[model samples]
Target: MDLEKRPREGSETWVDPRERPAGPAVRREPDAPEGCLAVAIRIPVRIVVLVLVVPVRMLWDALVVAGRFLNDTLLRPLGRALLWLGRAVFVWPFVGLWRYVVVPLGKALGWLGHVLLVVPLVWLYRYVLTPVGHAIAWAARGVGAGAGWIARGVGAALGWVYAWLLTPVGHAVMWVLKGIGAGLAALGIGVWTAVAWLARYLVVVPALWLYTWVLAPLGRAVAWCCKGLVWLLSTIVTGIGTALYWIARILFVLPALALWRWILTPAGRVLAVVGREVWDALGHAWRVAGHISLALGRLLGTLLRWIFVEPVRWVYRSVLTPVGHVVRDAVLRPAAEAARSVRRTTRQALAAARESVRQARADFRRMLFGEPRQPQPVDRREPSGREPRTLGSSTTALTKD
Candidate 1:
């Protein structure tokens, strides 16, 4: 309520209505015009141009479509046909050229390909494989040479051992054989000397004594006896000869003459008549001998015919014919058939018998032992340690146990 500074309304305290105070001035926006209405009143040229260009663009599109249709329907098809006709006109000649020239060129190219592939392989064989093969061959040759050297060394060593160790043994053996031979020779000489001396003493002296003392006298006595026997035989032969001559003259000669004169004359007449009768008898005897000879000849001929011809025929017919048949039927054919049967049967029987025996053995073993015997399995695994039994000394002790 202290009115000490009351000021007039229009004065500086009222801050003239048109002028702001000094601290803060009032800001006034400029009055811009309504540009949106003006923009709305202006005509849009893009819309007019769009309206006018649409019909013209449609007419141009129609012309393009008409051109595509004319090409597709007539012009393009005619062009394709002309190109096909041109290809057809040259096709046969092209094919002929390919067959005559190009095909041959292709074949040559294939051959060249093969040559190209093979040439490298051949080069590899020459430069790489050949050298490797030669190296292998050389290695083998070296190994063989080493083996040969070893063999030669072993042979030389063996030869040296034989010369040093065995040669003396062989010489000693030969000397022992020579000594034994000499001893045997000496024994044989002594035996021969003893036998010769014994023979001289036992046989020669006795033979000489007997010859001197007894044999000479016996020889003289035998000679004297032989001379006496010869003299007696000559005297007896002379006496018997003289007595026989006297007897023959006295007794036989006179009697023989008298008897011949008395009896021979009548006997001669009778003998004449008997001789005439016996003339026919001699013929009869000759006829009988001829008949006997004929009978013997016929008998011998019949026997010969029987032995050579008839008996051979009989043997062929009776023995050989039946024997051949019997051999074919009973021996040969039956033996072959029986052998075949026996072989088949033997195989089957052996198989069956083996099976039976095996079963029987299995049954017997099972019955005896209450279980079939099984073979002990062999251990393939490496042994962990040696068993006490495997030790030689321990095994010897175990044997006593």
Candidate 2:
């Protein structure tokens, strides 16, 4: 299909468009030409609105004026009366209480608190606590000084003893060791000289004669063999050491140098050359992934809107919300009213029961106890010329009566 020439109502040649009824043309007035008299004579929108709304505006202004007059005449006086009454009834007493009672009481309390608590605390801190702390500190300082003096004296005594006795003892011991060592050395030299003379005359002369007569040639042959063996082993050891030295140099040291020179240097250069490219590629990939993620999120949001949100919103608006309103009005409202009535009835019953219980208690008390007697007033006057009655005379008179 050719989208540009698509048909709206018909399929033939894809050229048909929808036909609809047309209403009569209603034209707007063209704007007045610039610098013309019509442009200069244009009425303001506010003026037009004012002309249209004059009666309503006048009515509103008259109402406002009447309201203001009424407020000023009646409400203002009433409000002032109420304010005056409030001041007289509530504010005056409060002010009096605060000024006369509360202020004086607060001042007294503050003075008492300062005198009883704060002043005592200050005195204690100043006199007792400070003196105690200073005394403790002085005692500690004196004890520390005494301890340090005693330690110094003890150390000096120990140093003196070391210098006087221990030094001489150590020197004497060292001298004794040197003398003993000299004596031992001299004895060892004499013993060695005697041993050498004895061996040379008694043993060496005979050994030399025997070697000259019988063993000299054999000894020379054995010596020659030993020299040859020693020379061969030395050569072998030297050759092995030289070989090992060259092998270690070629394998470990030379390869390390070559690796540093060739592989590590070139690898560093290559890494430097390609590091930026790799970083850029990674950054570009990250941005592309981020864009894809955002696009996916938007697409998912659109799909969710279309599939779930719109349907849920439609159902709520069309069905659930109206149902909820109906339920609230029909069921919940009546239930709330019934609950309030029940609560009121329950309160009335409870009050009636409480009254009945109180009446019953009062009746029970009246039944259990007879009427209580009222107390008589006492007469305290004494006769003019009579002495006060004694306790025995009063008791006898009461008995006679």
Candidate 3:
């Protein structure tokens, strides 16, 4: 091949072939493996297996054996011993404290509180507070009854006055006022009717007559004269407009219409027909393109289903899903059960702690305040009204007792 004479001129940079010395051609060599790969290949398989695989297998076996031995011999016993110790040292003591010591103490305190505090409070309320309250109530009732009797007498006098004297006077005054109001209303009505009649005759009638007889005719004559002038001007304007319309129709409109009807319409029809044909061709092409696009889409969908979707689905269903199941069974389920057990145990411990705190608080209160006082009901029923007595007399009688 004439390499120098070839399309070298098309490029921007040029070189003089005569001035440049040609170098030796670089002969391509066949690719060979690297030195490391050659060494790996040359090494004995038995030696490689002995150096790399045997130790790993031995380590794996040792780990398995050691784990089994530790679990069976050491871990299980240790776990059992820890569990037994925890129960004996912590759990049993807590249970016994709550059951025996805390519960009995609470019961005794409750009973003692009821007997010492509640019984005395009940007795004092019944004897001392109840009598004092009754005396106060009786004194208040006597004062209220006296005031009520006086009020009733005054109200009766006022009611009698209103019913007999004030009511009749108010009715008579109202009757007189109603009669006066009726008379004044009738007088106003008669005066208003008279004024309306006088206004109709004196003002409204004369105004109607003047408008009917003189002003209406004068207005009609003036309107007619103005209408005649307006009609004449409008007629002249209409004639001018009609003449211009006809002139435009003859000069421009008719010719334009003729041009459009004969030349443009036919040409437009031909162009429209050509356009319809071209549009149909383009539409057909677009339809074919759409079909091609649809086919390509279907093909792409099929390819995606085969290449990506089906393989992914298969991996999920066969590999990942089974692995998930195995993980759940081997790791997650046991971990979940352990968590639940721990949570239940923690809740029980917390509940017991809370109960112990409540008991301790009650014991502290009993120690400090000498147990809780119970409320006693006071007898609130009134005694017979026939046996009314003063506070001083009753107190003296009690002192003597």
Candidate 4:
């Protein structure tokens, strides 16, 4: 806002909904001041809206609490258990098979193929094929050199024959041909010169004379006649256009403009006033309705707590709690102790069986594969990819992580 629009120091700066804009003709205008119609609309609308919205808001709050409680107490743990079970039953077995069985078998097969096929192929390529290729290349080079020598000798003989014997004969023949060509060329030039002179006099001269004298004057006269016709037609079109423009203005444009300025404009202003009042009333009613709904929601919540929650809480704490404690101490504790004892004895028996099974498996494995090797620690200066960093570790750029 500009300085003129800003409120002055020490002035009451708060806006009043009832306040109208500062202007000379503000009273004459329809949409500025709030009217009796707005008050008539606002009061009933707010009351009706408050009544409708209170029940909805209360139900909405109840549903929100119920949903949160269900998600936390029932749905959340069930989802987690399902996720774990799915991984164990469907996903883990495939992952283990790929990692242990398929990967190792593939590696062994690849190693076997390399040893049996690739190694011999490499040996043949390096030892047998390489020597044979070198021998062929050496023979090819010898052949190429002999052929080149023979070609050079043949070329020298051909050059000598051309220079000593054929050169003189060719020169004599060329000299005779040049004399005959000179005579024919002189004769052709004379014939061509006579034909050109005849064509200039018979065709070109007459055509030029006809164009300069006859065609140019005729074209200019035709052009003048065309220009006169175009000028007369344009003048007639301009006069008709001017007459039509004035006729349309008087018949259509002037009356329509007068109707809008004198009639429709006033009616539209009145409609704007009614519409603005309705809009402002709706806005004020909505805000008032919100406050009323909030108050009603609080009142209903208080009533519900007194009627339902308080009674349930009282029953759980004052009645059910004592009964639960008595049952737990009198009968449940003794039963739990006996069950725990039985579980302990069964666990001991299962542990012994598991020990025997583990020993037997270990003996079988040792007999077949011998004792497992322990990994030796190595000194390193750089960190491994994706491993957590520590005080002793430093990373290198070659690590993708």
lDDT of each: 0.74, 0.75, 0.77, 0.81
| Cα-lDDT of candidate 1 | 0.74
Tens digits of per-residue lDDT, candidate 2, 1-401, equal 11123233323333112322366534344432333332222323223333444445445555776799999999999999999999999999999999999999999999999999999999999989999999999999999999999999999999999999999999999999999999999999999999999999999999999989779888899999999999999999999999999999999999999999999998886665455434544443444444555566588779999999999999999999999999999999999999999999999999999999999988898789955678996644333356765654433545443
Report the C-alpha displacement of residue 351, candidate 2, in angstroms.
1.3
- Off by more than 4 A, model 3: 1-262, 282-286, 374-401
Decreasing TM-score order of the candidates:
4, 3, 2, 1
Query: 183-284, model 3: which lDDT tens digit per residue?
Result: 999999999999999999999999999999999999999999999999999999999999999999999999999999999998897666555545544433
- Each candidate's TM vs. the true structure? 0.23, 0.31, 0.31, 0.65
Per-residue lDDT over 110-169 for candidate 1, one digit per residue giving the tens place of the 0 to 100 score: 899889998889999999999999999999999999999999999999999999999999
The numbered model that scores best in TM-score is: 4
Worst 10 residues of 4 by lDDT: 1-10
**Which residue pairs clash within candidate 4?**
none
What's the candidate order when arranged by decreasing lDDT?
Answer: 4, 3, 2, 1
Candidate 1 similarity to native, TM-score: 0.23
Candidate 4 residue runs with Cα over 4 Å from true position? 1-105, 165-170, 263-280, 341-401
